[model samples]
Target: MFTDEEFEKYLKELDNPDLSEFEFFTESTGVKVYRRYNKTSGLYDYKTIGGIDVPVDTCFAVYTDLEYRKKWDSYVKELYQFEEDGKKGVYWRVAFPFPLSNRDYVFVRETREFDLNGKHIYVCLGRSAEFKSKKEKSGVVRVNDFLQSMIFTSDGNGTKAFMHYYDNPRGMIPTWLINWAAKSGIPGFLAKMVIACNSYDKYLASKK
Candidate 1:
């Protein structure tokens, strides 16, 4: 735990961050996340799935539970037919009931969840939000259009997460606005992932 002095020092650093401090390093997973404010257009982020310690495999697997999702994850409702690795599935939009609520839970129609042929993204049981995988996507990552791509890499140690949001808004939004949204939203989303690991730990300990 950080002491009061240590916490103050940390806050001071955050206030006037060193650019070098923001630079990405080689994580055990070998995933490179370039964390930065979108100076040009969009935002990029690098963060652990959960703020606390989480083994990667433990993190990814828990991301698939269709029910009991609300216990850890914030802004997603019930999931339907959401495949783990195939390509596509369904999850509802949801809203959290508090300030700084990480997940933006809002239930949407199944049809709304997908495209003309159910060709899109929806939700993840745990890992990260859904999106056009550039390969596959569903609920959270799958916006009405291309929004952000949240990717994960797992090595023996743990997982490294990355996010890249399109710079410009589709309908009427501008690039900076969209980037701001990405910056504002991504951190909390990443931090909330701890719920998954913690919940699993509780489950395992209970079984023992």
Candidate 2:
């Protein structure tokens, strides 16, 4: 869950962000990424804009299906939901290349729908939170300072996606790793997501 102020601020940013404030990072396979410096975290905040050749509803379904994601996204080492002290959140562990420790996150995510100028928009937001049931593992970097907001809307026969991403992966990050994330990691994830969305229905059917 998010605070009212945070909700309002994120909505404004997603609805209308000043491009002048961000520097172009990279574009891959039709997906464009921009980044801006964050003084507080001493890290960069990224914006991903792209068009997916899938319906908005399908995109939402695929994005929210945590279990289904594990089947397609090979980068996810571990992912699941947990509830403790009457509060619930998700736990995620991501794989990293050799010489770098894996990264983990504990966060709560929410989805909302809105109508702006007669257009439907779906937003999925996530923020880092602590859970008594979850603890950091040894040799794994915990990403406690993280925020993600993704917007999805119909674009003709396809869907348009806008995502704002920020996270402190903890420890030292090499310049090459950052560049790889921008040029390949982000865009590659999106590309795989489209394939997942297209096959989500079949994935669900197999479960039944």
Local distance difference test, per candidate? 0.40, 0.84
Top candidate on lDDT is: 2
Candidate 1 per-residue lDDT over residues 119-180, each given as its tens digit: 22222212234534233224223233223333333433665443333322233345555545
Poorly placed runs, candidate 1 (over 4 Å): 1-52, 82-88, 96-143, 147-153, 164-178, 203-208
lDDT of 1: 0.40
The estimated TM-scores of all candidates read 0.42, 0.90
Q: Please, what are the lDDT tens digits per residue for candidate 2 over residues 1-208?
A: 6666765665666547657789999998777899988776666888988889999899988998899989999989999988888777999999988889999999998888888776788888898998877889999999998888888888878888888888888788854567556667788889899999989989989989
Residue 160 lDDT in candidate 2: 81
